[model samples]
Target: MSGPAVRFDAVGLKLGGVEILRDVNLSVAGGAIHCLIGPNGGGKTSLVRCLLGQMPHTGNIEVDWGENRTIGYVPQFLDFDKALPVTVSDFMAMVCQKRRPAFLGLNKSNRRLSDAALDRVGLNGKRKSKLGSLSGGERQRVLFAQALIPSPALLVLDEPMTSMDEVGAAVFVNIIRELAADGV
Candidate 1:
């Protein structure tokens, strides 16, 4: 909890007879903001995948956590049908609510939490709007909102600034600062 949140020792990855990552070594400290910078096909995403255990690799990857440590991830892409008629509120409810059945709908407390999270990302007014109608930036903000519901100790954001406009990016940076200040 107090030291490195993640440590990668001599990490190497290969796929289809090609080397993706080679001899990678790093340690990410707890409560610190770390960025992986590289060009396209530079193994940044692959490194993250390895850390998340989404891909197989060689070497030791260690995670240190306190009791009740939780992780929240916002992926680079969201794969959903563009024609789906799900509303933002409904989508949020599906992701944020754990105790309630989807058919049962969001409870009062869950609704409040979802609303607050949306408000943080300037998406409160669009809560009732259809998800398919949102712009790419708006959709990305909604993803950020979803990640804040449970407030994980470790938050992994992959290329979160990709589709964000100026205002959206500013809001994201501010929220990230606030989260870091709170030792998230």
Candidate 2:
């Protein structure tokens, strides 16, 4: 919490007889903003996956959380059935709800939090809209909002601005700065 949040030591990755990443050494300080920039298929996503434990790699990877550490992740892609009847509010409730079953309905406090998160991402009016009806950019914002619920000590965003408009991107950047300032 007080030092580096993550450290990579001579990290290397390979898949299907191909080298995806090699000799990668980096440190992400706690309460800081770090960006991974590279061309497509350049292993950016792979590195994220490795950090999240979604993929296997070789090397020493360490994550340091001083106390009360939790991780929140927003993935680069989301796949859902087009025919699902989920609403934006319902989706958020599922993500934010802790003790209550989703079908039991969102309590007043949870609803307020969900609404605020949606408003932060410029999706305030879409809370009751059908998830399947949203465009790709809207869906991405929804994902970002979901990640904000029950804030974590470490936030991992993989191509988080994908499909976002200028306004949404600006809001996201501001929120990231605020979170960092709060030592998240």
Candidate 3:
């Protein structure tokens, strides 16, 4: 599905009595990709949070979705207990499953989707492994895998390549190209 154009009009944000963003404006067309670059402590993440409705900001951030508004996000970081015994498959099941509990195992449809997404990120073989045992790169791949399950109309990624190796980066780039071509 083609995503909607996102428009940010005179957006401004403040937190703790400090201005984090000021009159920022941007527009991204549907089926297109946009990148935000800046140094540390810049307002990029804050702007994204505003767009996701996780933060309150001034001005307007609009996503003109026409009809469908399914959004997928791959965050820059995920924190969890390293000692937890959750397997990668368990993690996927937990996030994507609704009707059935993750511990009860993935239902048939979710199993197929999770498998394909994991394979796309080269994590199919690692599904049975504990999530804590994987390196940072592998964990990032897992996060990417989860974002692909529902085939979102709009995909938001923040520093998705942070810990990825060369091979993993190539895989990610390829998937992104494919998704864009398919009007993601």
Candidate 4:
């Protein structure tokens, strides 16, 4: 299957009787970066949420490549449970079309793929560590690894750089560029 260029035609969204966005049309061609900048409550996140179908919206979203495309997402903020028990390896394993981790049943190939994804996100060394032990930046990278681990054709990140430092943002930007370049 080929990757699709995302298109939004006259999309409109409303929530709790409040009209958040309307007539928002955007055509996102594949293999390019599209930036959305606006004020607080200016519907930037609303627009993104509409594209993600997290909320119902009017109009259309067309993928020009004409294939069943998979989407991976990371939210703007992740206040995870302090008692969460998953490790980095466990998170990466979720992207392999399994929907859930296999616990102790993964084969050699799956393990290799999970390893690669962790390495790509700079979290290889933390694979066996608890997710709660990671620093904020490291935790963000782990989230990135999980989202990108599947090598999905399209990645949608809402405020992906929200909590990162300058150096962390630079590193993540490079990773995003590389993923886009590799057609992930």
Top-lDDT candidate index:
3
Model 2: per-residue Cα lDDT at residue 122: 88
Estimate, for each residue in 1-184, the C-alpha lDDT of model 1 and write its tens digit: 3323889999999999899999999988887788999999999989989988999999989988876467777788678998988889989989977777655667888889889999999999998898989988889999999988887788889998878899999999999888887766
TM-score of every candidate relative to the true structure: 0.92, 0.89, 0.96, 0.85
Worst 10 residues of 1 by lDDT: 1-10
lDDT of each: 0.86, 0.86, 0.90, 0.75
Model 4 worst lDDT window (10 residues): 97-106
Off by over 4 Å in 2: 1-4
Score residue 19 of candidate 1 by CA lDDT.
98
Q: Write the per-residue lDDT of candidate 3 for residues 97-183, one digit (tens) a residue.
A: 987889998988899999999999998999899999998888989999999998888889888898899988999999999999888
Q: By TM-score, is 1 or 2 better?
A: 1
Report the lDDT of model 3 for residue 39.
Answer: 94
The backbone clash count of each candidate, in order, is 0, 1, 0, 0
> What is the Cα-based lDDT of residue 140 in candidate 3?
88
- Give me the runs in candidate 4 sitting further than 4 Å from their true place: 1-3, 66-68, 97-102
Q: Candidate 3 overall Cα lDDT vs. reference? A: 0.90
Q: Cα lDDT for residue 103, model 3?
A: 96
Choose 1 or 3, whichever is better by lDDT: 3
The candidate that achieves the highest TM-score relative to the unseen native structure = 3
Q: What is the per-residue lDDT of model 2 for residues 69-164, given as tens digits with 9 covering 90 to 100?
A: 677888996799968988898899899887898767689999998989899888999988989898877898899899888677888999988888
Q: Given candidate 2, what's the lDDT at residue 152?
A: 79
